[model samples]
Target: MKKTSIETYYELFYRWQRSGLSKAAFADREGISKVSFYAWCKKFETKPDSQDASTGFTRIELAESASQSAVAKISYPSGISVEL
Candidate 1:
Protein backbone atom coordinates (compact mmCIF):
# COMPACT_ATOMS: atom_id res chain seq x y z
CA MET A 1 0.00 0.00 0.00
CA LYS A 2 1.15 3.52 -0.77
CA LYS A 3 2.06 5.55 2.27
CA THR A 4 -0.14 8.57 3.00
CA SER A 5 0.79 11.70 4.88
CA ILE A 6 -0.42 12.41 8.39
CA GLU A 7 -2.25 15.49 7.13
CA THR A 8 -4.30 13.38 4.76
CA TYR A 9 -5.15 11.02 7.58
CA TYR A 10 -5.92 13.93 9.83
CA GLU A 11 -8.38 15.30 7.30
CA LEU A 12 -9.96 11.92 6.88
CA PHE A 13 -10.26 11.53 10.61
CA TYR A 14 -11.92 14.91 10.93
CA ARG A 15 -14.39 14.10 8.19
CA TRP A 16 -15.21 10.77 9.75
CA GLN A 17 -15.92 12.39 13.09
CA ARG A 18 -18.20 15.00 11.51
CA SER A 19 -19.91 12.60 9.15
CA GLY A 20 -21.81 10.79 11.90
CA LEU A 21 -21.40 7.58 10.00
CA SER A 22 -20.59 4.14 11.30
CA LYS A 23 -16.94 3.14 11.12
CA ALA A 24 -17.72 0.47 8.57
CA ALA A 25 -19.80 2.86 6.53
CA PHE A 26 -17.24 5.61 6.62
CA ALA A 27 -14.43 3.26 5.69
CA ASP A 28 -16.45 1.92 2.78
CA ARG A 29 -17.40 5.35 1.54
CA GLU A 30 -13.83 6.61 1.78
CA GLY A 31 -12.44 3.60 -0.04
CA ILE A 32 -10.04 2.68 2.75
CA SER A 33 -9.72 -0.59 4.55
CA LYS A 34 -11.54 -0.79 7.85
CA VAL A 35 -8.38 -1.98 9.56
CA SER A 36 -6.37 0.92 8.22
CA PHE A 37 -9.10 3.39 9.08
CA TYR A 38 -9.29 2.11 12.63
CA ALA A 39 -5.53 2.24 12.95
CA TRP A 40 -5.43 5.84 11.80
CA CYS A 41 -8.27 6.77 14.09
CA LYS A 42 -6.48 5.27 17.05
CA LYS A 43 -3.23 6.93 16.10
CA PHE A 44 -4.79 10.38 15.73
CA GLU A 45 -7.32 10.25 18.54
CA THR A 46 -5.27 12.30 20.88
CA LYS A 47 -6.68 14.89 23.27
CA PRO A 48 -6.19 18.41 22.04
CA ASP A 49 -3.48 20.33 23.87
CA SER A 50 -4.74 23.62 25.23
CA GLN A 51 -1.17 24.88 25.28
CA ASP A 52 -0.41 23.92 21.73
CA ALA A 53 0.61 27.04 19.86
CA SER A 54 -0.97 26.00 16.63
CA THR A 55 -4.42 25.90 18.23
CA GLY A 56 -3.80 28.50 20.89
CA PHE A 57 -4.49 32.20 20.62
CA THR A 58 -1.74 34.53 19.52
CA ARG A 59 -1.30 38.29 19.71
CA ILE A 60 -3.24 40.06 16.99
CA GLU A 61 -1.98 43.15 15.26
CA LEU A 62 -4.94 45.40 14.72
CA ALA A 63 -5.14 48.52 12.61
CA GLU A 64 -5.27 51.82 14.46
CA SER A 65 -8.97 52.23 13.80
CA ALA A 66 -9.80 48.64 14.75
CA SER A 67 -7.68 48.78 17.89
CA GLN A 68 -9.79 51.64 19.12
CA SER A 69 -12.94 49.56 18.84
CA ALA A 70 -14.20 47.41 21.71
CA VAL A 71 -14.58 44.26 19.70
CA ALA A 72 -11.83 41.70 19.55
CA LYS A 73 -11.32 39.12 16.86
CA ILE A 74 -10.29 35.50 17.13
CA SER A 75 -9.16 33.27 14.30
CA TYR A 76 -9.01 29.51 14.46
CA PRO A 77 -6.81 27.12 12.55
CA SER A 78 -9.90 25.81 10.83
CA GLY A 79 -10.33 29.12 9.03
CA ILE A 80 -13.13 30.24 11.34
CA SER A 81 -13.29 33.84 12.38
CA VAL A 82 -15.17 35.36 15.29
CA GLU A 83 -15.55 38.79 16.86
CA LEU A 84 -16.20 39.62 20.43
Candidate 2:
Protein backbone atom coordinates (compact mmCIF):
# COMPACT_ATOMS: atom_id res chain seq x y z
CA MET A 1 0.00 0.00 0.00
CA LYS A 2 1.22 3.47 -0.80
CA LYS A 3 1.90 5.81 2.09
CA THR A 4 -0.65 8.60 2.45
CA SER A 5 0.11 11.98 3.92
CA ILE A 6 -1.27 12.93 7.32
CA GLU A 7 -2.48 16.22 5.84
CA THR A 8 -4.60 14.38 3.32
CA TYR A 9 -6.06 12.21 6.03
CA TYR A 10 -6.76 15.27 8.13
CA GLU A 11 -8.67 16.84 5.26
CA LEU A 12 -10.56 13.64 4.71
CA PHE A 13 -11.49 13.47 8.38
CA TYR A 14 -12.80 17.01 8.33
CA ARG A 15 -14.85 16.35 5.22
CA TRP A 16 -16.16 13.07 6.49
CA GLN A 17 -17.38 14.63 9.71
CA ARG A 18 -19.40 17.13 7.70
CA SER A 19 -20.47 14.70 4.97
CA GLY A 20 -23.12 12.88 7.02
CA LEU A 21 -22.08 9.61 5.46
CA SER A 22 -21.27 6.41 7.29
CA LYS A 23 -17.59 5.62 7.60
CA ALA A 24 -18.01 2.58 5.38
CA ALA A 25 -19.71 4.61 2.69
CA PHE A 26 -17.09 7.33 2.92
CA ALA A 27 -14.30 4.83 2.61
CA ASP A 28 -15.96 3.32 -0.44
CA ARG A 29 -16.46 6.71 -2.03
CA GLU A 30 -12.85 7.69 -1.40
CA GLY A 31 -11.51 4.35 -2.67
CA ILE A 32 -9.67 3.67 0.56
CA SER A 33 -9.79 0.46 2.46
CA LYS A 34 -12.41 0.58 5.20
CA VAL A 35 -10.01 -1.00 7.65
CA SER A 36 -7.39 1.62 7.07
CA PHE A 37 -9.92 4.43 7.26
CA TYR A 38 -11.27 3.13 10.52
CA ALA A 39 -7.81 2.67 11.89
CA TRP A 40 -6.74 6.17 11.02
CA CYS A 41 -9.88 7.65 12.48
CA LYS A 42 -9.31 5.78 15.70
CA LYS A 43 -5.68 6.79 15.85
CA PHE A 44 -6.42 10.46 15.40
CA GLU A 45 -9.69 10.61 17.26
CA THR A 46 -8.00 11.70 20.46
CA LYS A 47 -6.12 14.55 18.81
CA PRO A 48 -7.20 18.11 19.41
CA ASP A 49 -8.09 20.34 16.48
CA SER A 50 -5.17 22.62 17.35
CA GLN A 51 -2.43 20.10 16.79
CA ASP A 52 1.22 20.43 17.70
CA ALA A 53 3.49 22.07 15.12
CA SER A 54 4.75 18.74 13.90
CA THR A 55 1.38 17.95 12.31
CA GLY A 56 1.33 21.20 10.29
CA PHE A 57 -2.27 21.89 11.31
CA THR A 58 -3.61 24.44 13.70
CA ARG A 59 -7.17 25.42 14.46
CA ILE A 60 -7.72 29.10 14.94
CA GLU A 61 -10.50 30.90 16.73
CA LEU A 62 -11.33 34.35 15.47
CA ALA A 63 -13.51 36.84 17.28
CA GLU A 64 -16.63 37.99 15.49
CA SER A 65 -16.30 41.26 13.59
CA ALA A 66 -17.56 44.27 15.50
CA SER A 67 -19.66 45.40 12.56
CA GLN A 68 -22.96 43.55 12.42
CA SER A 69 -23.27 44.25 8.69
CA ALA A 70 -20.06 42.50 7.87
CA VAL A 71 -20.55 39.38 5.81
CA ALA A 72 -19.16 36.17 7.15
CA LYS A 73 -17.16 34.14 4.70
CA ILE A 74 -15.49 30.77 4.62
CA SER A 75 -12.62 30.16 2.26
CA TYR A 76 -11.06 26.84 1.40
CA PRO A 77 -7.51 26.25 0.30
CA SER A 78 -8.93 24.94 -2.97
CA GLY A 79 -10.02 28.46 -3.97
CA ILE A 80 -13.64 27.90 -3.04
CA SER A 81 -15.35 30.65 -1.11
CA VAL A 82 -18.74 30.96 0.55
CA GLU A 83 -20.15 34.14 1.98
CA LEU A 84 -22.87 34.37 4.53
Candidate 3:
Protein backbone atom coordinates (compact mmCIF):
# COMPACT_ATOMS: atom_id res chain seq x y z
CA MET A 1 0.00 0.00 0.00
CA LYS A 2 1.22 3.53 -0.68
CA LYS A 3 1.94 5.87 2.23
CA THR A 4 -0.95 8.26 2.76
CA SER A 5 -0.61 11.97 3.56
CA ILE A 6 -2.24 13.65 6.51
CA GLU A 7 -4.73 15.43 4.28
CA THR A 8 -5.71 12.16 2.66
CA TYR A 9 -6.20 10.57 6.03
CA TYR A 10 -8.31 13.48 7.14
CA GLU A 11 -10.46 13.15 4.05
CA LEU A 12 -10.84 9.45 4.58
CA PHE A 13 -11.74 9.97 8.20
CA TYR A 14 -14.45 12.45 7.29
CA ARG A 15 -15.73 10.16 4.60
CA TRP A 16 -15.94 7.36 7.06
CA GLN A 17 -17.85 9.60 9.45
CA ARG A 18 -20.30 10.68 6.78
CA SER A 19 -20.73 7.17 5.45
CA GLY A 20 -22.16 6.10 8.78
CA LEU A 21 -20.23 2.87 8.62
CA SER A 22 -18.56 1.08 11.43
CA LYS A 23 -14.82 1.51 11.62
CA ALA A 24 -14.22 -2.15 10.88
CA ALA A 25 -16.61 -2.06 7.94
CA PHE A 26 -15.07 1.12 6.59
CA ALA A 27 -11.56 -0.22 6.96
CA ASP A 28 -12.48 -3.42 5.21
CA ARG A 29 -14.25 -1.61 2.41
CA GLU A 30 -11.36 0.81 2.01
CA GLY A 31 -8.80 -2.04 1.84
CA ILE A 32 -6.95 -0.85 4.92
CA SER A 33 -6.28 -2.60 8.15
CA LYS A 34 -8.38 -1.57 11.13
CA VAL A 35 -5.25 -0.76 13.11
CA SER A 36 -3.90 1.52 10.41
CA PHE A 37 -7.23 3.24 9.99
CA TYR A 38 -7.46 3.82 13.70
CA ALA A 39 -3.89 5.12 13.80
CA TRP A 40 -4.63 7.58 11.05
CA CYS A 41 -7.76 8.66 12.82
CA LYS A 42 -5.80 9.30 16.00
CA LYS A 43 -3.00 11.06 14.16
CA PHE A 44 -4.98 13.44 11.95
CA GLU A 45 -7.87 14.08 14.28
CA THR A 46 -7.92 17.58 15.77
CA LYS A 47 -4.15 18.10 15.13
CA PRO A 48 -1.86 19.04 18.01
CA ASP A 49 -2.12 22.81 17.72
CA SER A 50 -5.90 22.84 17.47
CA GLN A 51 -6.15 20.39 20.32
CA ASP A 52 -4.03 22.70 22.44
CA ALA A 53 -6.25 25.62 21.62
CA SER A 54 -9.34 23.73 22.77
CA THR A 55 -7.95 21.86 25.76
CA GLY A 56 -4.87 23.64 27.03
CA PHE A 57 -4.85 25.66 30.25
CA THR A 58 -4.85 29.43 30.14
CA ARG A 59 -4.37 32.30 32.53
CA ILE A 60 -7.34 33.19 34.70
CA GLU A 61 -8.29 36.48 36.28
CA LEU A 62 -10.20 37.03 39.47
CA ALA A 63 -12.56 39.98 39.60
CA GLU A 64 -14.82 41.27 42.32
CA SER A 65 -18.51 40.66 41.64
CA ALA A 66 -21.38 42.91 42.69
CA SER A 67 -22.02 40.65 45.66
CA GLN A 68 -18.42 41.02 46.82
CA SER A 69 -17.67 37.48 45.61
CA ALA A 70 -14.75 36.75 43.35
CA VAL A 71 -15.41 35.71 39.79
CA ALA A 72 -12.99 33.63 37.78
CA LYS A 73 -12.65 34.80 34.21
CA ILE A 74 -11.17 32.71 31.41
CA SER A 75 -10.50 33.93 27.93
CA TYR A 76 -10.14 31.89 24.80
CA PRO A 77 -8.19 32.68 21.65
CA SER A 78 -11.43 32.79 19.69
CA GLY A 79 -12.46 35.98 21.48
CA ILE A 80 -14.90 34.13 23.75
CA SER A 81 -14.81 34.67 27.47
CA VAL A 82 -16.28 32.68 30.37
CA GLU A 83 -16.95 33.80 33.89
CA LEU A 84 -17.48 31.54 36.85
Candidate 4:
Protein backbone atom coordinates (compact mmCIF):
# COMPACT_ATOMS: atom_id res chain seq x y z
CA MET A 1 0.00 0.00 0.00
CA LYS A 2 1.19 3.54 -0.70
CA LYS A 3 1.10 6.43 1.75
CA THR A 4 -1.35 9.30 1.18
CA SER A 5 -1.17 12.82 2.56
CA ILE A 6 -3.92 14.59 4.49
CA GLU A 7 -4.43 17.05 1.63
CA THR A 8 -4.97 14.19 -0.80
CA TYR A 9 -7.43 12.59 1.60
CA TYR A 10 -9.33 15.86 1.84
CA GLU A 11 -9.53 16.11 -1.94
CA LEU A 12 -10.74 12.54 -2.15
CA PHE A 13 -13.42 13.32 0.42
CA TYR A 14 -14.68 16.23 -1.67
CA ARG A 15 -14.66 14.19 -4.87
CA TRP A 16 -16.46 11.30 -3.22
CA GLN A 17 -19.28 13.61 -2.14
CA ARG A 18 -19.64 15.01 -5.66
CA SER A 19 -19.51 11.53 -7.20
CA GLY A 20 -22.58 10.45 -5.26
CA LEU A 21 -21.10 7.04 -4.64
CA SER A 22 -21.35 5.11 -1.41
CA LYS A 23 -18.42 5.47 0.94
CA ALA A 24 -17.35 1.87 0.51
CA ALA A 25 -17.56 2.07 -3.27
CA PHE A 26 -15.71 5.33 -3.43
CA ALA A 27 -13.00 4.07 -1.13
CA ASP A 28 -12.59 0.93 -3.22
CA ARG A 29 -12.32 2.96 -6.42
CA GLU A 30 -9.80 5.27 -4.79
CA GLY A 31 -7.64 2.32 -3.63
CA ILE A 32 -8.20 3.12 0.03
CA SER A 33 -9.79 1.33 2.94
CA LYS A 34 -13.41 2.29 3.58
CA VAL A 35 -12.81 2.22 7.31
CA SER A 36 -9.96 4.68 7.03
CA PHE A 37 -12.01 6.92 4.81
CA TYR A 38 -14.87 6.98 7.26
CA ALA A 39 -12.52 7.61 10.16
CA TRP A 40 -10.92 10.51 8.34
CA CYS A 41 -14.30 12.00 7.52
CA LYS A 42 -15.40 11.84 11.15
CA LYS A 43 -12.15 13.37 12.27
CA PHE A 44 -12.48 16.31 9.94
CA GLU A 45 -16.14 16.83 10.61
CA THR A 46 -15.79 16.86 14.39
CA LYS A 47 -12.61 18.89 14.57
CA PRO A 48 -13.63 22.15 16.23
CA ASP A 49 -11.14 24.17 14.24
CA SER A 50 -12.42 22.63 11.01
CA GLN A 51 -15.77 24.42 11.22
CA ASP A 52 -15.97 26.90 8.38
CA ALA A 53 -18.17 28.28 5.61
CA SER A 54 -16.98 25.62 3.16
CA THR A 55 -18.52 22.74 5.11
CA GLY A 56 -21.94 23.43 3.49
CA PHE A 57 -23.43 23.77 7.01
CA THR A 58 -24.08 26.96 8.87
CA ARG A 59 -25.10 27.91 12.40
CA ILE A 60 -28.23 30.00 12.36
CA GLU A 61 -29.92 31.77 15.23
CA LEU A 62 -33.58 32.74 15.18
CA ALA A 63 -35.02 35.39 17.40
CA GLU A 64 -37.98 34.61 19.60
CA SER A 65 -41.26 35.97 18.29
CA ALA A 66 -43.72 37.52 20.73
CA SER A 67 -46.68 36.77 18.44
CA GLN A 68 -47.83 33.39 17.18
CA SER A 69 -48.26 34.78 13.64
CA ALA A 70 -44.55 35.04 12.94
CA VAL A 71 -43.45 33.58 9.66
CA ALA A 72 -40.14 31.84 9.05
CA LYS A 73 -38.52 31.03 5.75
CA ILE A 74 -35.68 29.00 4.33
CA SER A 75 -34.05 29.54 0.96
CA TYR A 76 -31.95 27.03 -0.84
CA PRO A 77 -29.24 27.62 -3.41
CA SER A 78 -31.30 25.71 -5.98
CA GLY A 79 -33.98 28.43 -5.85
CA ILE A 80 -36.24 26.38 -3.61
CA SER A 81 -38.02 28.14 -0.79
CA VAL A 82 -39.88 26.93 2.30
CA GLU A 83 -41.99 29.00 4.70
CA LEU A 84 -43.30 28.24 8.14
Candidate 5:
Protein backbone atom coordinates (compact mmCIF):
# COMPACT_ATOMS: atom_id res chain seq x y z
CA MET A 1 0.00 0.00 0.00
CA LYS A 2 1.25 3.47 -0.82
CA LYS A 3 1.24 6.25 1.72
CA THR A 4 -1.50 8.69 0.72
CA SER A 5 -1.39 12.43 1.18
CA ILE A 6 -4.22 14.93 1.44
CA GLU A 7 -2.94 16.41 -1.79
CA THR A 8 -3.02 13.03 -3.54
CA TYR A 9 -6.58 12.30 -2.47
CA TYR A 10 -7.82 15.71 -3.56
CA GLU A 11 -5.95 15.45 -6.82
CA LEU A 12 -7.50 12.13 -7.65
CA PHE A 13 -10.96 13.33 -6.71
CA TYR A 14 -10.69 16.46 -8.82
CA ARG A 15 -9.31 14.55 -11.75
CA TRP A 16 -12.13 12.08 -11.59
CA GLN A 17 -14.68 14.87 -11.48
CA ARG A 18 -13.07 16.73 -14.33
CA SER A 19 -12.75 13.66 -16.50
CA GLY A 20 -16.40 12.80 -16.06
CA LEU A 21 -15.37 9.21 -15.43
CA SER A 22 -17.20 6.74 -13.29
CA LYS A 23 -15.67 5.93 -9.92
CA ALA A 24 -14.79 2.36 -10.80
CA ALA A 25 -13.39 3.37 -14.18
CA PHE A 26 -11.25 6.11 -12.68
CA ALA A 27 -9.93 3.85 -9.93
CA ASP A 28 -9.03 1.19 -12.46
CA ARG A 29 -7.33 3.68 -14.73
CA GLU A 30 -5.44 5.24 -11.84
CA GLY A 31 -4.17 1.87 -10.59
CA ILE A 32 -5.93 2.36 -7.24
CA SER A 33 -8.24 0.10 -5.31
CA LYS A 34 -11.98 0.61 -5.49
CA VAL A 35 -12.12 0.99 -1.71
CA SER A 36 -9.59 3.79 -1.93
CA PHE A 37 -11.72 5.61 -4.46
CA TYR A 38 -14.78 5.44 -2.23
CA ALA A 39 -12.74 6.45 0.79
CA TRP A 40 -11.42 9.48 -1.03
CA CYS A 41 -14.92 10.49 -2.07
CA LYS A 42 -16.14 10.17 1.50
CA LYS A 43 -13.39 12.42 2.73
CA PHE A 44 -13.48 15.02 -0.04
CA GLU A 45 -17.02 15.05 -1.35
CA THR A 46 -19.19 18.04 -0.46
CA LYS A 47 -21.84 16.86 1.95
CA PRO A 48 -25.42 17.91 1.34
CA ASP A 49 -27.20 19.68 4.15
CA SER A 50 -30.94 19.30 4.67
CA GLN A 51 -31.02 22.46 6.75
CA ASP A 52 -30.30 24.49 3.64
CA ALA A 53 -33.90 23.94 2.49
CA SER A 54 -35.10 25.74 5.61
CA THR A 55 -33.20 28.79 4.44
CA GLY A 56 -34.78 28.51 0.97
CA PHE A 57 -31.81 26.64 -0.40
CA THR A 58 -31.01 22.95 -0.56
CA ARG A 59 -27.91 20.97 -0.94
CA ILE A 60 -29.49 18.83 -3.65
CA GLU A 61 -30.39 22.01 -5.51
CA LEU A 62 -27.55 24.47 -5.72
CA ALA A 63 -29.51 27.64 -5.96
CA GLU A 64 -30.14 30.81 -4.01
CA SER A 65 -32.84 33.42 -4.42
CA ALA A 66 -31.92 36.54 -6.32
CA SER A 67 -31.87 39.85 -4.48
CA GLN A 68 -35.30 41.46 -4.35
CA SER A 69 -35.85 45.00 -5.60
CA ALA A 70 -38.55 46.60 -3.47
CA VAL A 71 -37.42 50.20 -3.21
CA ALA A 72 -39.59 52.63 -5.12
CA LYS A 73 -38.11 55.23 -7.44
CA ILE A 74 -37.55 58.67 -5.95
CA SER A 75 -39.35 61.76 -7.38
CA TYR A 76 -38.19 65.34 -6.66
CA PRO A 77 -40.08 68.60 -7.21
CA SER A 78 -38.73 70.98 -9.90
CA GLY A 79 -38.62 73.83 -7.29
CA ILE A 80 -35.72 72.16 -5.52
CA SER A 81 -32.28 73.70 -6.25
CA VAL A 82 -29.12 71.78 -5.65
CA GLU A 83 -25.42 72.72 -6.02
CA LEU A 84 -22.97 70.09 -6.99
Candidate 6:
Protein backbone atom coordinates (compact mmCIF):
# COMPACT_ATOMS: atom_id res chain seq x y z
CA MET A 1 0.00 0.00 0.00
CA LYS A 2 1.10 3.53 -0.67
CA LYS A 3 2.04 5.63 2.34
CA THR A 4 -0.70 8.14 3.16
CA SER A 5 -0.66 11.11 5.47
CA ILE A 6 -3.21 11.59 8.23
CA GLU A 7 -5.11 14.08 6.14
CA THR A 8 -5.29 11.67 3.24
CA TYR A 9 -6.40 8.84 5.49
CA TYR A 10 -9.13 10.95 7.03
CA GLU A 11 -10.21 12.20 3.63
CA LEU A 12 -10.22 8.67 2.35
CA PHE A 13 -12.09 7.58 5.41
CA TYR A 14 -14.66 10.31 5.03
CA ARG A 15 -15.07 9.70 1.35
CA TRP A 16 -15.28 5.97 1.74
CA GLN A 17 -17.81 6.34 4.49
CA ARG A 18 -20.00 8.87 2.70
CA SER A 19 -19.80 7.23 -0.69
CA GLY A 20 -21.77 4.19 0.49
CA LEU A 21 -19.25 2.02 -1.27
CA SER A 22 -18.96 -1.28 0.47
CA LYS A 23 -15.59 -2.00 1.95
CA ALA A 24 -14.41 -4.25 -0.84
CA ALA A 25 -15.62 -1.92 -3.58
CA PHE A 26 -14.28 1.22 -1.96
CA ALA A 27 -10.97 -0.37 -1.13
CA ASP A 28 -10.58 -1.47 -4.72
CA ARG A 29 -11.47 1.93 -6.07
CA GLU A 30 -9.24 3.75 -3.63
CA GLY A 31 -6.32 1.37 -4.00
CA ILE A 32 -6.68 0.46 -0.35
CA SER A 33 -6.40 -3.11 0.80
CA LYS A 34 -9.39 -4.95 2.20
CA VAL A 35 -7.75 -5.48 5.56
CA SER A 36 -7.22 -1.76 6.05
CA PHE A 37 -10.70 -0.94 4.95
CA TYR A 38 -12.24 -3.43 7.36
CA ALA A 39 -10.05 -2.09 10.09
CA TRP A 40 -11.37 1.40 9.52
CA CYS A 41 -14.93 0.18 9.33
CA LYS A 42 -14.63 -1.66 12.62
CA LYS A 43 -12.81 1.18 14.26
CA PHE A 44 -15.45 3.75 13.31
CA GLU A 45 -18.64 1.78 13.68
CA THR A 46 -20.22 3.98 16.29
CA LYS A 47 -22.38 6.34 14.29
CA PRO A 48 -25.63 4.39 14.27
CA ASP A 49 -28.70 6.60 14.04
CA SER A 50 -31.73 6.09 16.19
CA GLN A 51 -34.64 4.95 14.08
CA ASP A 52 -38.39 5.43 14.50
CA ALA A 53 -40.16 2.44 15.93
CA SER A 54 -42.96 2.73 13.39
CA THR A 55 -40.77 2.32 10.33
CA GLY A 56 -41.37 -1.43 10.29
CA PHE A 57 -37.86 -2.15 9.12
CA THR A 58 -37.73 -4.85 11.83
CA ARG A 59 -35.95 -4.26 15.07
CA ILE A 60 -32.86 -6.24 14.12
CA GLU A 61 -32.69 -4.91 10.56
CA LEU A 62 -33.25 -1.40 11.81
CA ALA A 63 -30.45 -1.72 14.26
CA GLU A 64 -28.13 -3.26 11.69
CA SER A 65 -29.09 -0.78 9.00
CA ALA A 66 -28.68 2.11 11.38
CA SER A 67 -25.25 0.88 12.30
CA GLN A 68 -24.37 0.41 8.65
CA SER A 69 -25.63 3.87 7.76
CA ALA A 70 -23.58 5.35 10.52
CA VAL A 71 -20.51 3.52 9.30
CA ALA A 72 -21.20 4.43 5.68
CA LYS A 73 -21.39 8.17 6.33
CA ILE A 74 -20.18 10.84 8.66
CA SER A 75 -21.01 14.43 9.53
CA TYR A 76 -18.45 16.87 10.76
CA PRO A 77 -19.04 19.81 13.04
CA SER A 78 -19.26 23.22 11.42
CA GLY A 79 -15.99 24.81 10.32
CA ILE A 80 -14.21 21.49 10.12
CA SER A 81 -13.02 20.58 6.68
CA VAL A 82 -11.77 17.23 5.51
CA GLU A 83 -9.18 19.09 3.46
CA LEU A 84 -7.40 20.15 6.59
Residues 1-84, candidate 5: write the lDDT tens digits: 678776677778878989988999999999988997898788666545352322444343323447553333333466655432
Tell me the alpha-carbon RMSD of every candidate.
8.9, 11.3, 9.2, 11.3, 15.6, 16.2
Comparing 1 and 2 on TM-score, the stronger one: 2
How do the residues 8-53 of candidate 4 rate in per-residue lDDT, one tens digit apiece?
7777877887898998999999889899899877766675543442
Candidate 5, which segments miss by more than 4 Å at Cα? 47-84
Error of 4 at 82 (Å): 38
Q: Estimate the overall C-alpha local distance difference test score of candidate 5.
A: 0.68
For candidate 3, lDDT tens digit of each residue in 7-56?
67677887998999988999999987799899877765646533333235
TM-score of 1: 0.54
Query: How well does each candidate superpose onto the true structure, as a TM-score?
Result: 0.54, 0.59, 0.50, 0.52, 0.52, 0.44
Give the least accurate 10-residue stretch of model 5, judged by summed lDDT: 51-60
Count of backbone collisions in candidate 2:
0
Which lDDT tens digits does candidate 1 get at residues 1-84?
Answer: 888776677788889999999878999998988998888788666635233223444455655564556776887889999997
lDDT of model number 2: 0.79
The residue ranges of model 2 lying beyond 4 angstroms of the native Cα positions read 52-84
Tens digits of per-residue lDDT, candidate 2, 1-84, equal: 798877677777778899999999999999988898897788678877677424556665657787877675788989999987
* Model 2 alpha-carbon miss at residue 24, Å: 0.5
Cα lDDT over the full model 4? 0.78
Q: After superposition, how far is residue 43 of candidate 3 from its true place, in Å?
A: 3.1
Models ranked on lDDT: 2, 4, 1, 3, 5, 6
Model 6: weakest 10-residue lDDT segment is: 53-62
Q: Which consecutive 10 residues in model 3 have the weakest lDDT in total?
A: 49-58
